[model samples]
Target: MTQEQWTAVDRYFTDLLVPPDPALDAALQTSAAAGLPPHNVSPNQGKLLLLLAQIQRARTILEIGTLGGYSTIWLARALPSDGRLITLEADPKHAEVARANIAGLSDIVDLRLGQALSTLPQIAAEGNSPFDLIFIDADKPNNPHYLAWALKLSRRGSLIIADNVVRNGAVIDQSSSDPSVLGVRRFNELLASEPRVSATAIQTVGSKGYDGFAIAIVTTDQ
Candidate 1:
């Protein structure tokens, strides 16, 4: 199928399966007002997250970025009553907005204001209690580092989803050498080569653009 065709399919499936939530909508508006980068996952991506979380019955989820808690709300809402999500954001201003936006979800979401690299290692040192789901949407340059950390902390059956894998398919052009594109390409290579995980890249387009993502399921024995 053509790229546009695939995008249409993605839109159709997402629309058919997931509807927007008021809390998430409010959070997106708040993020926009705060002048933060539009880093929050798309609603379709949010639905994919929810579906993956529910599939794993994820009790503990770790997110690398929480722009304004829009995606966090989607993931948290999919969990059981006692399930929890810990999200990291480097920008304190963004974190502030996220905290405010997620105020009503105090029971299930923890917004950590700090570098994800630092936070992730701390979580790893704490016995690496195998996260059921790990979502990476932080600085693109740190994609490889994030994947390594996630692999160390994820269980055998955990799901790891990385956003912006295609980067408008610039990742396929090895000669471009852009940091973000190179980083995403490296991430895809690692996931493809690793015997511990099985993954597939799905091209998607929406408010983001002619881009896509990768969903890797950790399948190795612990």
Candidate 2:
């Protein structure tokens, strides 16, 4: 269907299912006021993440992106009081804004400021492996690397979620030279061939336009 139709349907569904919260609203407004890219997940998607984390009964979560901490808040809410969530953001400015947005959640959410590649190793070295859930939503060009780290940081039965895989359906273009497209293609190939996990992706459309999420569960230890 048309983008207009898709957006309308998404709005209807979100309005019906996801109630407005002041903190979440402020996070979006503050991020916009700070001129951050509007790359945060939509309300419905955030709710989906919450539900997924809850469904997995995740006591520990790792998020590879922290854009103003919108999605981070949603994920963190799924945790019990003692549960932990570690989120990484490369840009200092973005991290600063996210820190403010997630002020009250400092106890449950750890906002790490650095490139994911660099910080991921630190997380591993810190004995933070075997995260119950891992969400990868950073730079698309590094998705395969993130997937590799996700495997390293997760145990069997850990849930791994990657966003923006469809890229408006550009993923099927074998001749595409765009680094993001190439990376997602490679990531999908790796997922398909990897015997350790069963994975799949579904195309989605809404306020954010055409994209999709790749979801998998670690079926075996790496």
Candidate 3:
């Protein structure tokens, strides 16, 4: 009925479905104590990410943003003991907070501190194996560029997800000067034209308000 109602329903269903997650709660508390923005994914969304990784049986995951490593932990926990998740964060302070939050996950979590545009090239140059799943949630202005890199670094059958695509219904305004909206428009066009992946955007509303995420699966024919 309303955003408040939607958010309340999200919390209601989350409590009825997901078991208690003290570690995740602690991570949020620590992040807040460190003065990080309260921009982490809600519990239900985090659980969705965890389940997505599990369903894909992903061994290697690449995340374009590591805001306090909240989502990073959810993805990491979905991996096998030897599975790895590499997250990129441009903010040194956020990266540091993420490192502290993921202290025991050193074996499976790799936090890279630098601009994704720069670090992604290094990863590609290293000739590292392609990530099985990639999550893009960084600066909205660079989403098109990020999608380009995501495609470049992904292998066939890889899953690519980009968050915050629909910012409060602003994505439909083509004439809008908002850089994020313009960037998402360009990114959506690119996704539509690219034959390398099959994708769709799923709109969502809840604690985060109106927004959507784009999910693409790399095709074998690409």
Candidate 4:
């Protein structure tokens, strides 16, 4: 079907399931007004993340991206009062907008400003390993690196989710020189070869067009 049809279906499902939230709407609006890339997750996708975090009983979360804190709010909502979430953003402008968007969650959400490659190490040094859940959605070229850090920061039973793996079904292109595609390919290969985790990716279509998420559960620390 066409993207229009997919988006229409997404709207129908969202209207039926995902209720309107003033804060979420404002986050989107502010992001657009600030000219940030429209890379935030769709409302339904955000709800899925929320449900997954809740099901995992995640007390600690690590997010590799914080575009405008749209998904951050959704994931943070899944946490208990004492729960904590650390989200990394490299762009100063995006981080500023996200900071405003998630201001209410200042206590629950830690927005780190720096390249994730840099900040992730600091998080580990600070003994923030064994996060209950990790979401990787930053620059695609660094997805493999992010996955490596996710593994280092996770424990057995921890859930790891990576977004934009499908890239409109371009992931299967063996000849693709696109850095994002190459990164996802390597990430998938690593997941397949790594015996410590069991994982799978599912293709999806919605307002964002064809894309998918790679989900994995760390099964062994050995």
* Residues 88-141, model 3: lDDT tens digits: 999999999999999989999989999999999998898755889999999999
The per-model lDDT (C-alpha) reads 0.85, 0.96, 0.91, 0.96
lDDT score for candidate 2 against the true structure: 0.96
List, residue by residue over 1-222, the lDDT tens digit for candidate 4.
999999999999999999999999999999999999999999999999999999999999999999999999999999999999999999999999999999999999999999999999899999987899999999999998999999999999999999999999899999999999999999999999989899999999999989999999999983
- Candidate 1 lDDT over 42-132, as tens digits, reads 7788887888888888999998888888888888888888887889999899899999998998998878788998888787776645889
Q: Which 10 residues in a row give candidate 3 its minimum summed lDDT?
A: 213-222
Query: Between candidates 1 and 2, which one is better according to TM-score?
Result: 2
Model 1 — TM-score against the truth?
0.90
Error of 4 at 217 (Å): 0.0
> Which 10 consecutive positions of candidate 4 have the poorest summed lDDT?
213-222
**Model 4 spans > 4 angstroms off:** none
Which one wins by TM-score: 2 or 3? 2
- TM-score, candidate 2, is 0.99
- TM-score per candidate, in order? 0.90, 0.99, 0.97, 0.99
